[model samples]
Target: MSHRRPLPRGLRLTVTDEGPGFPPEFLPRAVDRFARAEASRTSEGAGLGLAFVQAVALAHGGTAHAENTEHGGAVTLDLPC
Candidate 1:
């Protein structure tokens, strides 16, 4: 991970990583409670992390999204204050 500077107005924050990317359809349900892109039989965690993130965004009038990165993949949350 890289050190993050305070966001600048009109500039978007991007988070990227090298990891297995989720399917396109997964985005629609990424915030669903207990919905795990990787089945519990294979993946770790109870799958609440993303849901929690989405909740925080909605609560703050922001937004969250997931997309395939050119090299790896990433999930991005944009909050306007």
Candidate 2:
């Protein structure tokens, strides 16, 4: 976790997985409602997890981010403390 400097009084939380990571094309829409990576479509999920996370961050006057790391995917939520 990290401090939100010059932005707000909050903390940024990040979660990452050591999986195949997300597709490049899906990065832009990763936080969209119901958006899911093709590899996850076959799994059990409604694809709203990230969307909900983003919504909560926004509601808290913060933001959310997603990205594919060298070894996996990462999702981050910045929220007011």
Candidate 3:
């Protein structure tokens, strides 16, 4: 799912997926480089996706956040309009 809304000084874009959410312990460090939820390191990612998102958001003077809903996970990027 995707959603967009206007803020006072920016726009918020939220993307949600229905896959299993990130592990509970991984939530705090979700934006860190090479931070993977899978302990075995067998997942398909190098764990840089969220980190890249965060970096891009910061470079644009914005912010990124990750959270879990009842059914899945959501990432929200708030960027300057």
The TM-scores of all predictions, comma-separated, are: 0.72, 0.80, 0.90
The residue-by-residue lDDT of candidate 3 on 1-81, one tens digit each, is 999999999999999999998788888999899888886976588889999999999999999988898879899999997
Tens digits of per-residue lDDT, candidate 1, 1-81, equal 322334554223456677767767777887778877757457577878778877977787777666776665666766675
Error of 3 at 34 (Å): 0.5
| Lowest lDDT block of 10, candidate 3 | 35-44
Model 2, 1-81: lDDT tens per residue? 233243357687878888888888998999999888885366888789999989999998889989877868888887776
Pitting candidate 1 against candidate 3, the one with the higher lDDT is 3
Candidate with best lDDT: 3
lDDT of 3 at 56: 97
The TM-score obtained by model 1 is 0.72
Looking at model 1, residue 14 earns an lDDT score of 55
Model 2 misplacement above 4 A: 1-8
Order by lDDT, highest first = 3, 2, 1
lDDT, candidates in the order shown? 0.67, 0.81, 0.91
Per-residue lDDT value at 6 in model 2: 38
